[model samples]
Target chain A: MNALWILAVNEYLDGLRNRWVAAAIMLLGGTALALLLVGSAPTGTVGAGALEISVVSLTSLSVYLVPLIALLLSFDALVGEFERGTMLLLLTYPVARWQVVLGKFFGHMMILLTAVAVGYGAAALFTVLVSDSGTAGWQAYLTMMSSSLLLGAAFIALGYLISVLVRERSTAAGAAVVLWLIVVVLYDLALLGVLLADHAQQIGPGLFSALMLASPTDTYRILNLTAFDSVGQAAGIAGVAARSGFAVSLLLGLMTLWVVVPLATTMALFQRREL
Target chain B: MVNAAAVEKVIDVAGAVKRYGDKTVVRDVDLSVRAGEHMVLIGHNGAGKTTLMKLMLGLTRPSAGRVRVLGADPATAGAGRRRALGYLPESVAFHSAMKGREVLAFYARLKGIAPAECRSIFEQVGLDRAADRPVRTYSKGMRQRLGLAQAMLGKPQLLFLDEPTSGLDPSLRRHFYGLIDTLSRSGTTSLTSSHSLNEVEARADRIAIMKMGAIVACGTQAELSRQAGLPIVVRLGVRSGSGARVAESLAAMGKIHRRDEHRIDLFCLGASKMVVLRQIAALGEVVEDVDVMPPRLDDIYSHYMENVQPQ
Candidate 1:
């Protein structure tokens, strides 16, 4: 346990000193702030809450940026250590291999969590101060922040899995980018293609929901845009939400599963690795 | 539950073999190091010195036999037992973003040592002045010192250092061996691998020479020199006019190699060195000077490394 904390703290400090974590925070905050100020201008004329509209716009932006940031942050975690020869020395210490994996996971997750909270929190604060938004708007904003953190964590876990499976950092980097493309862009496009081809109307709502739940990016989009009625209507996904008949708890659970499965597999594979 | 004095061998490897696919890197070999012993492993590239060290450190398990360090199988040893072992890899590295002080503190914490002790270690390695700087700015010598300092954390009972002095300056290499000697006096056993034979010649209490994935010879320098039966050379600096006369006087003593008019080298076995030396001494004014050279660690190493049969 002590070893785990030591390794985790070391990794976190490494991230801070490298300035990548700070860059990620600035990027998220700047983009979210832009969405809040410009994208939500029509909300006041329409008589809708400003934070609700900001949530809808931010979710769309986050689906692309958050996963990319997470992958960039963690794609080299294990393979970089191996290449630098640090992992060989580290394993000789008193720490177990699983502790090393968990410790790095915690550290990377902390960076992502902090970036999401501070970035989205700053944007939400601006909305609350400049606009007349109710408790419902605040609640939807908070859910968006937490769910965005979960989404980033799921990708971070996937990146770690890639790091452990590959022998070289270049291969891991390529694999991470390819993984992001397939899950974030190609998966949804393929789903649309299936829908377009199914002109006979054979695919049911249940199958569609199951397919969406399979990809973490889709699960995150559904969770943020459809969890609240105001946000769902503002984002124009209320009809899909109603057709799917999914619960908020189920989507959150699926995102958590995305984090667990890949991370657990990374630990198992890392333990058996010869380096 | 076992006392230090009760265990004769700090590290024991019995018929250990390691195979990756069809290639056997470490053959069936047995090696044992006593407590406080300084054992140096000398071999050529890909001769399995590093692989054997990995097997004993538990980083890689042997395919055929067992390895025990500090009275337990290193592969299955508990974390508590691991705290007693320290290892410095061939090319040790740190997170480039970290400062020197942070790197030591991080490893210290993982080893269950107090972070405060890292300050003195920096001083010990002459890195205190640069401790606050990022590791990316460090030179190769500084990085090598940092590797040594980290391996000394908590004064571990056993140390496995691979090419520990590869990047160190000559003076620092001397200090490193001095530190190892001090640790050995205080009951710390060290198993180090090196390609620089002369650097470890006077430092290693026992030497293990490996060839073709197996230990071909293991003993002290004198014992190995004796076992190898390599000839010692006696060079005589003769007067300008006495070279031929001196060579004729010592013709029956040993084989002679004449370099020029002034010098002739006599090669004789260890048993006949005294007789050969006395024969030259008896030549009186004919031989101007006599220089006796014993077989060096390099010669013994080559004798074993070259004469071994392919496995």
Candidate 2:
């Protein structure tokens, strides 16, 4: 096996053993199931489709939850190894610095993918079993799941960037939480506040779409809620989707950029790092 | 592998300087190790011993100068070249959830050794019985042994061990050094850093004493002792009430240190050792026993460190 594969496999196994990962997986799975079963009660009464309603709810859930989970899983990846003295021993082996960073990136990405698949996959299965939404519903749900994974990849990359930038595990953790708050919670709130204050003048559609694409969660929101007619109309983003003029390909490209740029920067910084 | 006819330089560090910002961790350090040589680095904490070892292993690039391990710059060496080097950090830590056997196998695969090779290495490091146990369950000494087991994998031509015996018991320490000895005999060049001077004194072929990021002294025990100019101590066990008499008689020969009423230690240069011993023999009945102590590595280390310290 390649050395990078070995390191990645070890990282994946190590991540599985962590109590926090287990808890996060459970939390996501349980919340996703609950949202599908209990939170979808209003869909039946309101005459809205169950899959459409759950899509909206689950997208919001992912926006808040997936990035947090990704950050939590990866914040300590690099700095923790350095603090624990494993990085020194690891670097001594016949492995390149880029291999280490990429290995860890893939490993953490796999963990997040597994969590999202099992957590959100089970919920999507439940929604499909009970609902009669047909192909369009399944399409939107699949897009949500895949785009959720992409959003997670972006955050995991950002977490690695934080891991390499900081000197201590505690510092990386603190930076990760702050980053999560900024991208997930505060960025949207601040943007909404800006849009609300500029209601008279109105933010331009082009500038508005660019601003939304700045945060991975917003891009994820736009992708899942705007990709389809039924889900987009139900989620109240159809007008924003029509005005934003973002193709599925373009939004996906932006998310890919989010994953690659931070990872590339992390590799570059880690290469020159003293440890 | 044990080609005694042709000597191979495993590690060559020339004028290597490592700086973290303005503070220099390793400065103008030049060192070389030959195949089958067991070199021990002794220094105080923060003496750049670990940093120097990192440079030799190519774990970190020197800010200036050059470091070549196995005739290639460690910082730029390819995977094949790096596969020939092994290192055990001062504090060895592994994934706590991993079984000892699994951890060794992973490292073995990274070093391009067959997974089957891990079994023998486990036995070699005395970690066979605990191979299936999780690393979290192992004690500190067990972890150290596990680290050694990994470092010894693939029969690395050059091994860099930083405080390899930190938490080992006396017997395990002996076993560890014996393993190094066995590997050395097989032409594996080993560079080990240690604070346990007395234990490493007998095993190390050459000792390099580092202080404040520089090699203040480097040589075999005898050579270092000669360079330090430290005297050998001869202690005499005198009969009761004869301590004062022996002290006065020994005072004329050389400097005398009264250990207690029953003993007096004589400090004499190497040349005057026999002359002092002959004088002590003439006072035969006054002295019951005599212990001629040569300068130990600890003494030589302290002497060199003291001389290097600014007044």
The per-model DockQ list reads: 0.66, 0.60
Instruction: Give the alpha carbon lDDT tens digit for every residue of B112-194 in model 2.
Output: 88999898888888889999999999998899999999989988888889999887889988898899889988988889998
Q: Which tens-of-lDDT digit does each residue in A100-159 have in candidate 1?
A: 888988898888887898888888888888876644478888888888889998999999
Give candidate 1's whole-model lDDT.
Answer: 0.88
Clashing pairs in 2: none
| Candidate 1 clash figure, as a count | 0
Instruction: Show the colliding residue pairs in model 1.
Output: none
Docking class of 1: medium
Name the runs in model 1 displaced over 4 angstroms.
A44-48, B2-6, B236-252, B258-264, B275-289
lDDT of 2 at B203: 87
TM-score of each: 0.94, 0.90
For each candidate in the order shown, give its overall lDDT on alpha carbons.
0.88, 0.85
* Tens digits of lDDT, candidate 2, A1-275: 88788888888888777665577678788998987787756564434466777889999999999999889888998999899888888888889889999898878877877888788778877887777764347777878888988998999999999999999899999999999999899999999899889967668867887898888888899888888877877776677767667888999999999999999999999988876
Cand. 1 TM to true fold: 0.94
Q: What is the DockQ of candidate 2?
A: 0.60
